[model samples]
Target: MSLEQDVATARQALEALDRACASVTKHVGETVDARRLRGDLSRVRDDLDLMAGQQSYSAYEPFAGVYGDGDDEGFGGAGRTGR
Candidate 1:
């Protein structure tokens, strides 16, 4: 998969883990291991946020609208319909 998809998947998994951790805390009480897990999750989430902040848009959709619609006469039929 693409980097964007991979990151999104990681984020979803992290969120699920976070929720599960909370649920476990309710039953097991606040244990040292649980606290450590929570801290680790927070650090991972921060890393993901930093990665997103530095994401290069050009790396995702390399040619999303580069050719435009083939309705016009411009290169790739882009024309100037909306210009």
Candidate 2:
């Protein structure tokens, strides 16, 4: 199949996986493992969304300032610079 077809198939599979995850969550309360799994699934779905253009790349975008020059320090800036 073509690349577009493969992406479509993967999207559908992700949708089905989402439904299954929901069903499992409903049947069994959101245990620790279940919550962790859900979090992981959410991240995967977000990635798929980014691939499908359903979501923007803003979250993954690079910071607009330097790291130690009193800038935003990107994402992992602890207590070194600006917020």
Among these predictions, the greatest lDDT belongs to 1
Clashes of 2: 0
Task: In angstroms, give how far residue 27 of model 2 lies from its true place.
Answer: 2.1
Model 1: residues >4 Å from true position, as ranges?
53-83
* TM-scores, each model vs. reference: 0.54, 0.55
Give lDDT tens digits, candidate 2, residues 1-83: 87667778987898899888888888889799789988777777677677766754535645444333555545766566544
- Lowest lDDT 10-residue stretch of candidate 2: 59-68
Task: Give the Cα lDDT of each candidate.
Answer: 0.77, 0.73
lDDT, residue 41, candidate 2? 76
Q: How many clashes show up per model?
A: 0, 0
